[model samples]
Target chain A: MKKNVFTTVTLLARSAGILLFFLYLGKGIQFISHLPIPGSIFGLLLLFLGLNLRLIPLDYVLPTGSFLLNYITLFFVPVGVGLLQYSDLLSTHWLTIVVSSVISTIATLISVGWLYQRFAK
Target chain B: MIYLYLIATILVFLVSRKLLIPIKSPLANPLLVSILFFIGLFSFTPLIYQDYATANLPFIWLLEPAVVALAIPLFSQIKQIKKQFRAIMISCCFGVVIAISTCLSTALLLTDDKILLLSLLPKSVTSPIAMAIANETGGLASLAAAVVIAVGLLGALGGFSLLNLCKITNPQAQGLAMGCSAHAIGTAKAIEVGNEQGAFSSLALVISGILTAVLAPLFAWLIGIIITI
Candidate 1:
């Protein structure tokens, strides 16, 4: 029972940390920058800096980070499902979309790999 | 209540995943299956996309925290990141420039529509970043989002064949290529390969997202110039 209570408290603390970072730090920067980039990206940078500065504890953020990352793909499902609304647009340009993405994806993969091997060595 | 929709969505994904356990295809991602399931429901049932989106807002909001949480893995892998910092930066730059230019030029050749061209500009980045950039650049955000997902799914499914064809053996290079090219979904596939690749992929995702955010407008302007020429 004691350990169970401790686990609950830990979960709560971790979640609180995550919320504060996203709601406060992340959104705050977005409000300031007025750039097209999402606030979460700014929040990520702040979190990284905070961690390096020891302002945010690793133990505090690790559980939340890993937990959220594990389900990162799931969170995208709603938006993926949102794709159904675009059936007409997608079908209209299906050839360009498929051909460009496939060709570019392969091109990127090859180029990055080739550059990294050359530069790293 | 909203909880019902949330539960049902998760349930559908779980069921779809379970059903695909025997299939070895990388294309059978939970995101794809769940989206298909939801799309089917929307067609046959009374559910509308707006209602589903509104009901699922809380879960969608979790994406923010997930983004913030990315710092942890990045921090843990800082040593590797620092060691190869220059190479990583250079390769990511190469990847982004190559990705954007190729997609734009090809789309431009296929259609004279500029919005469609802009939508494909940020396709190499993650969905949120792509959507945000698309909106700012006069592209259709919704179309960009869908295109982003399609690019991710395509990369996740067929990326490895390209890697094998290129004979990319270094885990760092592989992760860099995957993340730079495919964004989050590619990173997911990278993680499945190994921890090191996962770290580099995560790094690539963040850096490439930032680069695309900053450079997309400039790239769009350049595309305009090239078109006029």
Candidate 2:
């Protein structure tokens, strides 16, 4: 009976946490729409404020947060698939995208790597 | 209709997680798995991309708060972040400049599409910052999102492999480089390498994001001036 109760509480907490996340997500969207910045960006800022103010404990939300984070890539699947509609755009500009991405990545690696090596001393 | 896409997303996630463990390679990355799944689905189904996107919109909406949640880790490490304040500031500035300049220069020389150029500007930063930069620079947020994911996947798949090739055996160096360059995806790889590396990498990801957000516009302005002159 004790174990079952514990399980129930945990499940309740998880559901509650997810609910709170959605609530905040809604508020975040609303906040962003009125601002000059993007809604999602605003939502992130609101989340930061909530965490910093201790209105929400990381521990309480971590299970849900981590679950979301883990599958972040999956969230982008639809976007990637949407790229199919832009295949002609991609093909025509393939060289530019490929070259820019590769060069920028290498440049980032070198700059950050060098800086870390220097200051990590 | 949208429910079907959500269901598909959940199914893909489950299958990818199971398949990823056995491969132990970035190629088997969950994001890559989902992307491939979506691709196959799109190819096989007659459903238009628009309908699929409309159904998947909620997931996209989640991107903002999820990024903000990254600040949770940053807040947790506040003390350490404070201690390394100067180093972090300087490194962030340098990282941002290099990231923006390289991307812009390459794009200018290689392509003339203003839209694509704008979209690519924020590719190095985390998604939120990338989206902001794209918006400020007159790019589509959705396009920037695509670029950021592509950059992240490239980093996750090839970062460690590249580190090994370069004989960069130091965990701290590897983690910092990966995190700064690759953001979350690289940090994921960093965690697999070790705890210390993961911690440092996570630190780099946050710092780089903050720095990139502040600097992308300034660098773009400078690039614009140089081009005009």
TM-score of chain A of 1: 0.85
Q: What is the C-alpha RMSD of each candidate to the true structure, in Å?
A: 2.2, 4.0
DockQ, every prediction: 0.70, 0.43
lDDT (10s digit) by residue, model 1, range B70-105 = 677778888878888999999999899999988887
Chain B TM-scores, listed for every candidate in order, come to: 0.89, 0.78
lDDT of candidate 2 over B43-73, digit per residue (tens): 7888666777888888776554455454555
lDDT of 2 by residue, A45-115 (tens): 55556767887666766765665555555666665566676666566767887898888888777666667
lDDT of 1 by residue, A37-66 (tens): 678877878888888889877877766677
lDDT of 1 at B158: 76
Displacement of the residue B175 alpha carbon in candidate 2, Å: 4.4
DockQ for candidate 2, C-alpha atoms: 0.43
Candidate 1: Cα lDDT at B127 = 83
Lowest summed lDDT across 10 adjacent residues in model 2 chain A is found at: A34-43
Worst 10 residues of 2 chain B by lDDT: B64-73
What is the DockQ score, from 0 to 1, of model 1? 0.70
Deviation in Å, model 2, residue B46 alpha carbon: 2.5
